[model samples]
Target: MTMPDINYDILRRVAETASAYRYKDIWITVGPEDGQLVIRVHDAKPTCEDCAIFPIAKVDYGSSPSVEVATIGSESNPVDLLNLEVPAGQMIPAGTYAADAVFWSQSAVEKFMIPYYASVYGDQADVVVQTLLTVLKPAAQDGSEPDPAFAIAHLPGSEYVTLANEGLPHLFLIRQSGRVEGAAKR
Candidate 1:
C-alpha cells in the first residue's frame, strides 16, 4: 500500500498544546508533501553552549497488534537545533499508528534520566538508557518484531491530546486504507 496523506496543522496544534504542559522549545511537525513527521527542538544554543536535543518517539499501533519505538534522527547537531523525522513508509506502516515524542536535551538525559535508570539497572543503566537515544530502523516488513533488546518509554496522554482537542487546527488525516488519524506530542 502507498503512504497516506498527512495533516500537518494538527501536528502543530499538538505541539502547541504539549508545549503548555512541558518544554516550550520543542515542536512537532509533519511534511505533507514528503509524507514525513518531524519533531524539532529549538532555542537551546543560547542557554547551553554544548547542549543537544534528542527527539524520542514511541509509536503505538492500534489497528495492528504491536507497539514500537523507531528512532529516525539522532545526529548531534550543534547545540542550537535538532529534529527527528520519520518517513511514512519506513516508520509507519499501512495500519493506524498513534505516535508521541519527547524532546530531551543531551545534558538533561545525562544529568537526570541516565542516573535514574542507573539506580534501577545498576551498571547497565548507561547502556540501557541508550535505547532511548539510539537510532532505530522500522519494524521488519515480514511481520517480525523490532529489536527486543531495547525498550522505549511511552509518553502517556500525548496522543489523546492531539485527537481529543476540539479547537481549531484539528487533525484530519485520511489514509489510503480509509482510516482517519492524527499525530501526537508530549
Candidate 2:
C-alpha cells in the first residue's frame, strides 16, 4: 500500500509558526523547487551576529531520525541566511512525517490538529495531549477519513486552515519506491 503524501505546508507551519510565536524576529522561507529552506533574522541581523533561526524540532513522523534524505546540515551562523537543502551527490530517504493521524482518520483531524498546532506553534503547547484528544475527538467528524493527497492544498475553511495554508513557500513531499525519480511536481 502507498503511504500518504507528507504535507510540507503543515511541517513548515509547525516549524515557522512555533518559532514565530517564540521568536517574533525570525523569518522563514521554503523553497522546495530549489530544495532548500532559508531562515534569517528579520531586521535583527548584524547586531546579534551569531543569531540563527532554525526549527527547534521538525514534525517528522518516522520512527527514526532524519537520514541523509536531505543534506541534513546546519547553516553556519552570522550569515545572511540559513539554508536547509537536499545536498548534492547524496541519496535522500522516502519517509518523513506528514499529517499521519489526519490521513488515517479524517474524523480525528481536528483532534489531532489542535494539539499538533499547539505543539508546533499555538499558545496551548502546555496542554496535555490526552486532554486535547478527549476534547477534540468528541467534536471531530466521524465515519469517513479525508484523503491525504489533498493535505497540501490551501483548502477553504476555518481560520486555522487559512493559517496553515500560509507556510514555507514551495515546499513539497517526496514519495519513494526503491529508486529516486528526477525532481517532479506533485
> Pick by lDDT: which candidate is best?
1
The list of candidate 1 runs beyond 4 A from truth reads: 1-101, 130-186
Q: What local lDDT does model 1 show for residue 28?
A: 36
Count backbone overlaps in model 2. Answer: 3
True-vs-predicted CA distance for residue 36, candidate 2, Å = 16
| Per-residue accuracy of model 1 over 1-186 as CA lDDT, tens digit each | 232344444444344445433522343333222233332233232232222233323333333334444442224421111122223432222233343433334454456555654554455446546643441223456856532211222232233223222211212222222223332211
Which tens-of-lDDT digit does each residue in 63-129 have in candidate 2?
A: 5433332221124421111122222222122222222111223345345554554555444344423
User: How much is 89 displaced in model 1, in angstroms?
Assistant: 13
Question: lDDT (CA) for every model shown?
Answer: 0.33, 0.29
